[model samples]
Target: MRVLGVDPGLTRCGVGVIESGRAREIACLGVGVVRTPSTDELADRLMAVAEGVEGWMDAHRPEVVAVERVFSQQNVRTVMGTAQVSGIVALAAARRDLPVAFHTPSAVKAAISGSGRADKRQVTTMITKILGLESPPKPADAADALALAVCHLWRAPMSDRIAEAEAKAAQLARNHRARLADAARERGSTGGQQR
Candidate 1:
């Protein structure tokens, strides 16, 4: 499948496009950041990001768009800005009706490095190795975006299976609990005792 991955930010959003399946391969369709001048108003910056993403979508026509999910941290302002950027990324995908998926940082790390706690450098190293590139993609952010796409390629199916399994297990647990409660009530009524 052809997938476009986006690492969204107001000042510099990273983008990467890759095609995979049938064979494990990738073409560096494009990689770069969307930059808006610092002097520009925040609203303008956001608009630029959205426009940039739209342009990429038009050019690449990816079947799916994978984006990193915004993580809330101690810095509320940063979190808010990241959330806005993520929203734009989602909107861009929605505009095209392309399938969109989100990957958490931990999921990306685990997919790339077999460990959720892997550091950025480790993730970068794995990406480079997987792509068989002599050097890492530029601007770190661009590399990260590529990594996110790769992570989704590897993890999306597994995640779906896990979610399905969990849902089934939860339903079973609920049914078992209800049966136990029903049995208890029946026993209480038959005994007709206040014990």
Candidate 2:
């Protein structure tokens, strides 16, 4: 599966594409950051981000998109910008009918590293090692996007299985209800004929 991970921010939103093979091997197809000028109008800045995200989506044609969940920061403005960028990311993917997943920072850290409390350095180091890159991806945002992609790839199989199981259970319930209804109809028909 190919996944596009987005680490959204107003100034520098990071985007990464990663493909995972059935054998669990992973490859980094691309990684980059989209920068919007702080001086630009809010609407223009958001448009730039939307265009950037759309370009990645077109280039990668990812099977799924993963975005970092926005967390409350001390700076309300910063959080608001991040949330706005995140919404743009999701909207871009939604336009193409691609599935989107949101992962918390801690969840991403735990998926890449061993601990949820891992620092940025540790997360970057683990991502570099996992991708077999000689150096870590620059600008923590890029690394974070890569981590989100990897995390989704790693968890997607289990998620798929769970979804399949739920679907199957729903089908069985539907079938059972149909059988019961059919039986009731048959019995009613036979009783009316006798009457």
Best by lDDT: 2
Model 1 regions more than 4 Å off: 160-195
Q: What TM-score, to 2 decimals, does candidate 2 have? A: 0.84
Lowest lDDT 10-residue stretch of candidate 2: 19-28
lDDT of each: 0.85, 0.92
1-195, model 1: which lDDT tens digit per residue?
778989877777889887774666765677778877778988988998899888989998998999988888637876787789999889879878998999888888898899999988988898888877778887877888888888887776688899999999999999999999999999999889756
For model 1, give the 10-residue run with minimal summed lDDT: 21-30
| Model 2 C-alpha lDDT per residue in residues 1-195, reported as the tens digit of each score | 899999999999999999886576788899999999999999999999999989999998999999999989649999999999999899889989999999999899999997999999998999899887777998999999999999998777778899999999999999999999999999999989999
Candidate 2 Cα RMSD (Å): 3.2
How does each model score on TM-score?
0.79, 0.84
lDDT of 2: 0.92
